[model samples]
Target: MQRKIRFNKAPLLGDDLIYVEQAIKSGLTFGDGTLTREVESILQDQFDDAAGILLTSSCTHALEIIAILLDLNKDDEIIVPSFTFCSTASAFMMQGAKIIFADSEIPTMNIDPQSIENLITPNTKAIVVVHYGGLGCKMEKIMNIAKENNLIVIEDNAHGFFGSMNQKQLGSFGDFSTLSFHGTKNISCGEGGALIVNNDRFLDRARVVREKGTNRFNFKSGKIKKYEWIDLGSSYLMSEISAGILKKQLLNSNKIQMGRKIIWMRYLNALSEWAEENDITLPSKPHNYTHAYHAFHMIFPSFETTKSFLKYMEDLGIEAISHYVPLHNAPIVLQTEKRTKELNLCPNSSIYSDRLVRLPLYYGLELSSVDYVIEKVLSFVVEKQKSKF
Candidate 1:
């Protein structure tokens, strides 16, 4: 009998269980407990000694906090990659933003800086970029674009945690960054995230925004007599239970990160030849990048080949799946967004989104299992030639 391989497994390779038990016993399972602050501190130190860090319920919520902080409205436009999770655009949309979707770079599938520059207008207030698959985007270019236009840069860094470009951390480049501790992420706490505020001016407001429009953080720091609702916000706080788990995950980062890196390299090394012969494109390993080792994906020659390859993996009891569909092409966006004036704004986004497939990658995934997956992946045939979606 063959063993089943999962696309991703929620990690438990450390003392997270112990911390969870302690948090429950302490009767402080609410958000902002001691354990939660510790997680925030860990992230702050690791991500460029960030000025303000707030643990949130999810990366999506963290983005929402920034959206509220910016006071976005219909008069303001925000540029985001079409190839990203919906929250990247929807968060700002909830704040009445005009979502301007941009194309992706072929090298890394991150938002293309040129596309971003072209999309910017007088009304463009922010540029949101996702570091797809833990690989850093062209942040230097993106940051320069933002600087030139005086637009805020928000990094939806759910996939890039410790990953870096030019030896600086991925989540540290933007004016504001958000991290995901989703079960599928490299360092997970079942369901948690953090907001990393790099700009000093927004540091105070970010805390209030995360605390449901209240100045509670000020009150806690003895800067105020009482906390009250002062701005647009929500209960975007992460629970102590999740933070307890996250604390241990952070503490065990060395072992976990190393293990995942080894596995990711195994796939890269073994699949190189097979991928070349099959006309499949592996994830880019640029000289300047330290990958977060989030997920290993392949870009097949065509959507048909991608579909067939996924089914082949499924038949072998090895789970593989496709990633985000182009956000501009998503049903909700197509139905609600008014983009008749500028058609096919993100062509590259549609091309890659339809032709990509992601394999399993997680901490403690056995080398032998990884080898088996490599072998099975090598056996798939790519009869279909590259074609339009």
Candidate 2:
């Protein structure tokens, strides 16, 4: 039997268990413990934001915290990419804001800044951009648009940790950004995340919100005699055990990043010729940007070919899969009042929605496994071409 290849496996590149044991031995496995503070401190320094970092239960929770911090109103419109995870829009939607979806551009599936400009209105409050596949978006143009309109920029850097644009960090460009340490991401704590508060004004309230809408953080520091529910919030704090694992992962980040880069390059080099022959589109890395190598994706010739490719990989025991369905045409949003007007505005996004697929690219993935996957892909494409002839 062939060895089973997983779509993704959490990176265990360091003494993760040892740190977890250390947190257990300290007998303080709750939120805001020593290990939690240590992890937060490392991230704060990495993003180079003196404002602060708040470790959260997941990237979703970090996004939620951002929505609350912005104090968005029902009519407030947030321009976001339609080719992203639902949480990106749902977070702001939960705060009663309208989601004005933008289409994705190819060569880098990041949101098109031009589409964002077209969608902005007096009611637009923020521009939420996802750095798709860890590649940096065109922040220079996006930032200028945001500045001219006074719209807030939020980087959904779930695919980007330590990735940079024009030598400046990706998450640092936006007024605020969020990172994911989910099992599939570059850094893993099984399930964890962080909120990067770039602007100082939101820092104090961010702490209070993560602590559940109370002044408890200040009270704990003895700044106030007693804590009170001073604002609307939710419980988003990450447990110390997760933070313990995360701290160790952070220390080994360079090693993990290097290993992933090796795997990504191998796939690119092996499949480039085959991809061109078959008219398949591979992920593009811009000259001035650096990526985290989160996942390897390609655009198949058609939806039928993408499905066939997925099934072929699965038969060979390789776990490859399709990416997100275009959010605008999704059932939940299709029934909304904005359905007719919003659907299919992003032609490229709609085309790729059915064609994009991700191959396994994780920290511990072996070179042999990548080669095997490449071989299987080439074989499948060759067979399809022969059938056509």
Candidate 3:
């Protein structure tokens, strides 16, 4: 029987278990323990002097933490690409902010900055941009637009840790940003994340929010006599166990990144000819940007071809998958946004959502596995179809 390849496997490269056991034996398995603080310190240094780095339970929680800081009102709106994870919108929505969906641009599949400009309204409080696949978005343009309108910029950098644009770190450009240590990310702590407080004003509140609405951060740091509930927040803390594993991953990132780069380039080199012949789009990063190599994805000729490719790979014991269905078209949103005009607001997003397919890319994937995946991908052909989305 052919060995089955997984869609993703959490990277376990260095002292993951060693640190986990250390956390356990030391009895400091709670949040903000030594290992957790160490990871945050390392991230702060790496993220180009970010004002604060607070590790959270997950990236979703990281977004939620930012949401807490925003203090949104019902009419206050945030613009995000329709091509991103639901958390990108849902986090703000949970705080009663209206999400104004924007279309995605081709090639990079990052949010179209122009669409964001068009979507902005007087009620727009901020613009949240996701660096899809760790490829930096057009931050220079986006930041200028934000500055012109005085709108806040938040980087949903869940896929963009270690990535940079124009030699500057990606997450650092936004007023605030986030990092994911989820199993699927380029880095893994199994289940963890961090909030990068680029704007120092939010640093104090971020701590309170991550600590369940309390100023316990100051109390713990020996700066306050007593801690109390001072703001609206939640428990978004990552336990020391997860933080320990994350520290090891962070330490080994250079080696892990180099390995993933090799795999990504191999796929690109081997499949470029095939992709060109079939008009399928392969993953790429711009010259001035450094991709974090979270996952390698391709745009199939059609949704039918995407489905067919996934099925073909599965039959060969290779697990392949499609990505986010546009949140604008998700059933929950469709109930109120059922009108055809509203549904078509982000046409590029809808099209790209249907055609994108992701292949497994992780530090632990063996060289043989990478070659096997490339061989399987190259052998698959895009079937011509009259029907289109």
Q: Which candidate ranks first by lDDT, i.e. highest?
A: 2
Per-residue CA lDDT of candidate 2, range 2-35, in tens? 8789989888764568888998999989888888
Q: Each candidate's lDDT (Cα)? A: 0.87, 0.88, 0.87
Per-residue C-alpha lDDT of model 3 across residues 286-346, encoded as one tens digit per residue: 7999988887889988888888888888888987788888877777677655554454878
- Separate clash counts for every candidate: 0, 0, 0
Q: What global local distance difference test value does model 1 have?
A: 0.87
| Candidate 1 residue 284 C-alpha distance from true site, Å | 1.1
Per-residue lDDT of 216-275 in model 1, one digit per residue for the tens? 888877998988989878899998888888888889888888998999999999999988
Best by TM-score: 2
Candidate 1: Cα lDDT at 311: 83
What C-alpha lDDT does candidate 3 achieve relative to the native structure?
Answer: 0.87
lDDT, candidate 1, at 11: 72
Question: Residue 320, candidate 2: how far off, in angstroms?
Answer: 0.9
Worst 10 residues of 2 by lDDT: 335-344
Model 1 spans > 4 angstroms off: 338-342, 382-389
